[model samples]
Target: MSTPKLYAGLKLREIRTNLGLTQKAFAGKLGVSLPYLNQMENNHRPVSAGVVLALAREFRLDVTELSTDDAERIVSDMREALADPVFGPAAPPIADLRLAASNAPALARAFLDLHRAYRRTHERLASLDEALDTKDATLRPSPWEEVRDFFHYCDNYIDAVDRAAEHFASPAGRPGDPMRAAQEALAHQGVTFTRADGPWLRYFDPDTKQLTLSSRAPGSTQRFQALHQVALLAQNELLEATLDLARFQTAEARAIAKIGLANYFAGAALMPYRLFMAAAQETRHDLERLADRFGASIEQVAHRLSTLQRPGAKGIPFFFVRVDQAGTITKRHSATRLQFARFGGACPLWNVHRAFETPGRFLRQLAETPDGVRYLCLAREVSKPAGSFRAPVRRYSIGLGCEVQHAGALVYADDLDLTRSFEPIGISCRICERPDCHQRSVPPLERRLSVDPGKRGILPYEIGG
Candidate 1:
């Protein structure tokens, strides 16, 4: 097998522009001719080894940024978008999609946005009540989805926010109790803290300067709620600055993102980055042990693990997702090459779907996607009790996994035969290229289908080559 040539024109151009250098000046720094630099920047030619070395030595660049992370993500998203039935049976080839994603990412994002708008409009039109509502008829993207993509494209890592949370968690270069820090911060703001029986987990009265948490909530929940309030009261300006940088299209999205950011701050502060990263490594990425160490829940521990992409001090790239019993993905993030389905449930073959059956036990599976990527997946059911028997209990299955190559770092992979035949999985049925999938909910949009009234195999229709 030959090595794949790197074509990182977009990243090269970005680096150059950020340095405030023209093509000639940048070329001079990289010891390349202006035309040669232009060729590399335009992706007409692969970036040479000398240029990569210059980027590291002269510019102090991470060089790993030149890798195809964003490009791959864009390509995967484009593939999912094009798999829409509206695209008919003639979707563009994967090579073409890769080219567009690599050379013209902005245009690729624009196309994804257009498709998202079309999807929203189609859904609105499908429901008469929704079509009648003027508010629902707008083509504006879903605020939740818009916020999701913001974090998605950022690799679920916000540098400034993460650093600030770390500082709060470890003031004066010494590790401190985040719960205590949050309480002191709230008290300094003249906010009285108390717990009471209420349906809501956390509630704050701005006028009275009173912050209240539910008495019935667990200790971890209470601590998290306190930290979340600290984010709102103490880190308001920082959160706003981050939101401004995000530049969400709608006020709804901006508001939604503020809560998300505050939640992020809470999580980061709860499990301070350096402390958590070191503990994760020492414990071999054991979720239960990490949760016990960090005073966090299993779900919180898993979610925090996925956000360990802090550039210089990164952990193993992992994917985290939470799905309801109905199979709708409620939350998702992937630092790995495995991107989840953007608009639907995950692959049914995945162990996450079966987590509901065996309530507390962790389900493990070695699965392979159609693209030949193998992963060690772990799933367990998480339940959020409403603190009262009469109140509804919310249950979701959370999955955390990394590529098979990283399996040694996970305690859950113990005793599992990595060399065994892996269960096949996919992102979504419409985008899945596996023709013989018995669990396929729908046929792939890109393939031609042959209807055989006389005979059938796994599917009623045969997918064409």
Candidate 2:
């Protein structure tokens, strides 16, 4: 029996029909003859890179989706075919194939679409498995995980404004203070700040050529405004450099990684590596003192402190997590090899939730997992920016922690009792098989148990030992 053809000519034809475009009109948009376009849709010709790019740009669709015809097998086949030497011996032929890719676009479109579909499907399956194991499973992998992994491997930290500032201040070592340098950089970009009556107008005229800054908070707010200005001016260069460093083979992956890297650079620029690392070590990772010195919020100082793992010159390895009252984790970053349950919710006993009860007060706790891994947790609540006086403001919490062995290096552990029998918690339900845990939001895998109404336990159900 012959192998089934994975080409997606039919799908291309469907897309053309959906667009309400005639063959001739579609061909014209691709800069190809109608017959050539028809040939591609009929699988008489192969799809190339140029055609894929055109379809992606013109239709505003993901290139992979457009190329793979939304089929995984087709994408796998195409990748295999591209790796074959039988296509040609010379580079010029491949270059030509790329130039006239639109003329034979079906194959390329089919391959990309299939790959994306496969990835999404696999991720969904993983999520389902996690859900069955733990009730508090995540909707997907943490976005911060995706972002941080991209930056750690990628090279080239080129930021345009930073570059311009570096060039501008090459003779003076990029200015003495990072905040002052950032302010000067923004001035060069025609962005200026002025005091405003309300907090809603903190950053104004974002649509205009000249950006404006307005804030109610006197000191730290000004520093944040400068940081944002730097981010705006340097985002593109930082994104491009980081993406290049990541070396993503697919266009889709590159685009996603770019956004994450740009955010990373913005955060880094605001913190300034050298000074931040120095302060973290001196203060023993004290959030309050670091916040005061940098004119940053408590959360900002903690977040920056977590990213201080730059190889040989690293500070204490820390994990930072952010969550709202609803228990949804918004951000997570770790320098150590901390394993988070990919599919379930965090332990309710964790000190992160305690921050909400105390509002602005910081809470510290020692926690250990069944695996014997211990952690030192410091958590505090933070309020979101308010829109208007009548509008209800929202508050969220952030948690910063490190291993128990490294706890002594942090100021949060100074007054806390290290020997206290703190609560034992796990990252997620499926991985944590603690039989007597009253806080188990979901049951562990392969464990059968039922609730006995006559003998009610601390939790809803009793697990068989």
Q: Name the candidate that leads on lDDT.
A: 1
User: What's the CA RMSD for each of the models?
Assistant: 2.2, 18.0
Counted clashes in each candidate structure: 0, 22
lDDT of 2 at 235: 53
lDDT by residue for model 2 over 248-327, one digit each (tens)? 64566676665554445545655666666777889888788888776678877887777665433456767788887888
lDDT score at residue 259, model 1, on the 0-100 scale? 91
Please list the C-alpha lDDT of all candidates, in the order they appear: 0.90, 0.61
| Shift in Å, residue 185, candidate 1 | 0.2
- Write candidate 1's Cα lDDT for 223-317 as tens digits: 99999999999999999999999999889999999999999999999999999999999999999999898899999999999999887688888
Q: Where in model 2 is the C-alpha error above 4 Å? A: 1-179, 192-208, 217-222, 247-262, 446-455
Error of 1 at 325 (Å): 0.3
- Kindly report the root-mean-square deviation of model 2 from the true structure over all alpha carbons: 18.0
Q: Which ten residues in a row have the lowest lDDT in candidate 2?
A: 68-77
